[model samples]
Target: MTLLTVRRDGEIAVVTLDNPPVNAISEAVRKGLYEMVGHLDADPEVKAVVLICAGRTFLAGADVSEFGKPPVEPHLPDVVDRIEAAEKPWVAAIHGAALGGGFEIAMGCRFRVAVESAKVGLPEVTLGVIPGASGTVRTPRLAGVEAAVDLVTGGRPMSAGRALKTGLIDAVVSDLESDAVAFARKALGADLPVPASKRPLDQMPEEFWQAALKSASKAGHQAPLRALDSLRFATENGFAEAMAHERETFLDLRGSEEAAALRHVFFAERAAPKPAALKGVEPRPFRTVGVIGGGTMGAGIAGACREAGMEIILIERDAEAVARGLDNMGKIFDGAVKRGKLTQEGRAERMAGVRGSTDYAELAQVDLVIEAVFEEIGVKRAVFAALGRVCRSDAVLATNTSYLDPRAIAEGLPNPERFIGLHFFSPAHIMKLLEIVPTPDTAPDVLATGFALGRALNKVPVRAGICEGFIGNRILKRYRAEAEALVIQGVPIAEIDAAMRDYGFRMGPFEAQDLGGLDIAFLQREGARAAGQEVPETLGDTLVRAGRKGQKTAGGWYDYAEGDRTPQPSAAVTELLAGWTAGSLDLPRTEIAERLVGAMAAEGQAILDEGIAQTPQDIDLVEVHGYGFPRWKGGPMFATGAS
Candidate 1:
């Protein structure tokens, strides 16, 4: 298709880019921009150019399809540089997002104007690289050194209003095309602003640089700090020198393991919401949702659906339960208000849309109903049974069971095809991971609807086949087991936790269990043992039997002093598990990390072979999003290259 076309509006030539979807800066697009400069410069009739894009967005960023490939001719930096050097001035009219290389190209223009809703940023640090094409250099020149440091290092886009305040854009207009053309016409004879490359960068104090570097430094990640370094270098050196340094940093990180891992996750996340298997299937539309139970998980589900603009019908067993459910949901909105994510007025408006009831009959008209009641199979089945009786035959019913077999829960429910399992992580509104488990009788449309809900909720949905713990929990079980095995082998508990923290997890497996409470998993194992299954006792089970249930009890594997959450190794635990412990053995921290990750990967491969998980990337996504597997290392499967 035609990527570029120029139309004349008097003396102003409006140049439009027509790359569909996100209008990425591909090699052909780069060459087109490069050639368009010379073409526009030669025409004296074209006094100026208004750069805008067709389809969804302006230029979003560099073509990710070209990642890890050889460099093509007329590279992005050269194209942007050629645009800046053109005889005719250019005004960039942006909508949607101009990010990474896209924003770099915008900075190359004489002026930038965007719609009020448009956003712009240099988000290369998210992909494990610094902006190579003048982002670090030009940003500081356009804005200031501190702003550039925050923008480039944080890798989050700012709104057009914020960009205007930061001096990143010239104006925010309603009519993008006509206003941009008029803007170009007005500036034709006026003194144009100095080119970003030639503009002197704002200098910051040495102490500011030091603090910026420290703030940018993240565990097991290098790109943020490196991005800050580029911005610092631009202020201390010439523009060309800093640009070269930025390019070198980008190229160096492009081939690094962290970059590759981030790319793996990026692609996985992009492909997650809509799977290939559900490509042609149309999902059933859902607007009003019914959620059973008023506890943490149920309230979170209701809050998330409400946040997604769906009307929520929260159901509980009785009047008191319904009141508590609404209160739980109110707390969620309160937190949102506290965090400035939602205004008090907006919270009241959203909360007004929520209707709580004790009767399942209230769910008769809901397009979908998710049961987030107790985890027991009997309680879950009972909830679905009530839903089957009250809901429409076409209305979708979902269970939020973390470990129970979905097939078993839907056994007696009518219209099994419309029933599916949506295992949302705790605080479902906040967590991104949603395991979409489909039973054998689940309809394609129902399965598609699950993915659609995931998209609506802005979650990473990974389709999982029926298994005891599904994908994430199964791997988590293995991870915890591996950590326990290391402890049994006489490795210091604190040392193992330290090793995992070094490997980039926010908390070690044991420490995380302590905070979340050990009885959560212990009860699951107890249920299995009660069902006449041959289940071996775990270290956590031993602790639970001794009335030590983690931070809630002020002790578990470690001791918690009063309100303090920090875990101090318990001497009583050492004596309790003395029967299983071997002589003291000290292994390298690297080996401990390898064993844990290797164990998780091994479990992931087993899941893949058993058809519980669709792809290696799916497992990676589940671990990263659900269980706090350090995203920079990819997932366990990607890190080990297993399955």
Candidate 2:
């Protein structure tokens, strides 16, 4: 593809990487870069080299397509080394994102300059590996040890402004090419800085390293800690030794189970937003959205749509309810302000775009309307009925019902083709998962519009066929069932939760249920029972019936102190459920995690077999993004090799 090409401007030579779509550092690009080092070093007329990318971003990272393949010649580390050893000093001109191998290559240059809005990072830890191409070794040499620790272990990009403050880049420029060229020209005569490989290393105390290690330890993922260890090793040893350690660590973890799981999730997430089936289909544009219901879910949905620059009409049954809905959305925006995510002015501006009303006529102008009312068939049907009469025939109608039949909800809608189910997780603005469910009658573009909205809202959209709970909750139902079965079989609830936490989940099933209130699911089951379905009783029903609804009631599967959220083993719960238990069996946490994950995967397999989900990856995404499945374990489907 002729990924690398050079052109001369006076005494400065510009090397542009032409690889399209992120310009990932592929083998061909690596070979070209390695050869160019010597070619540029030999050029008598080239006094300085300005390295930049042609498309949207500088080299984003190593080519993910090359992952798990046989190693090619001219490895990234050697190419970076060759760049550092070149006779002519190099200036990395960065824009968009320079991450992982890209950042390492930038480190190899004598100087790095970026546009003000550009970002740079070493994010290999996210994929279950440390950076392989002198990322750990050269980062601390370029920036300090503390900054290196944050860049490598935390696995998030730093803006160019922050990068300059941290000494990761020389300057933040306005016009990338010309400013970078002038930056290189000025640097040719100025006292040139030492190569990143030769820069003095920063040393930190043991306590500092211990704190860094603790901070880097996220759940049970190994990459973060290992990345920190590499940075620490760089501080302790010479550049060459640290480089070798980092490379060895990267190679060792690349074949590990955690890395493979992460890779599975990585590919799954990449393929989710735009599925292959809708390649040629174009979604209808929806700039104005109507959200019915002013409760928690509706407010969150409206806030999320508003954040995506969509005009929102938050409709409720009454004016008071509409006021409450606006307040609820205000609380969401207020929280963002508190977190420094939004300014008060920005929040006000966003809220200004949202118009609250009680009239269905207000929704007439909306391109789409999502109903987030009570999860009753009649209530939802009435909302849709009103929407059917007022909304445009071409308007996309979506239901945010978690468990009800979407097909039944859209029963008498005017245009059944425009009806779809968009099951957004609670705290919609914060949660990333959005299940895009298509009924049998849903048109392709309508389905595409749902996915399009999901993207606009910055969500991970998974296409799900109409089924009870769709993909996520269906698996969650089985997961909770398996946990209950464990409790019945003598596994301690606290012990089960502990095992899951060790396995990388932030909370176990019972603990999460207690936090979310056990009554929610219990009520769902009760609703199903009321519908004349053969719903069986579970341990949770017994708890809810006893008036333990969760944190609000200060009890559920466990007891809570006055205001403390810590779960204490409840004698009341034990006495209440003693009748359900068979005999006590002390099981290790690993076994408990394995059994639970296996159960979820088994349910996922059934879902796939029934064509409820398009692929195993979709199920995995559902669990990882919607439910609290540990990302490093991939999802139940990938973890259990059911994919």
TM-score: model 2 vs. ground truth: 0.99
> How many backbone overlaps does candidate 1 show?
0
- What TM-score does structure 1 among the candidates reach? 0.99
Worst 10 residues of 1 by lDDT: 211-220
TM-scores for all predictions: 0.99, 0.99
Assess each prediction's global lDDT (C-alpha) against the native.
0.92, 0.92
Model 1 agreement with the true structure over 322-353: per-residue lDDT tens digits: 99999999999999999989999999988999
**Could you tell me the lDDT of residue 611 within candidate 1?**
97
Write candidate 2's Cα lDDT for 1-643 as tens digits.
6888899989999999999899999999999999998898898999999999998999999898899997798989998998988899999999999999998999889899999989999888889998999988988887799999998898899999999988999999999999999999998888988898888986799999989878887547999998888889899998889989998999999999999998999999899999999999999989999999989999999999999999999999998999999999999999999999999999999999999999999988789999999989999999999999999999999999899999999998898999999999999989999999899999999999998998899999999888888888988999999999999999888999999988988999999999899989999999999889999999999999999999989999999999799999999999999999987989988999999999999999999999999999999999989888889999998898887
Clashing pairs in 1: none
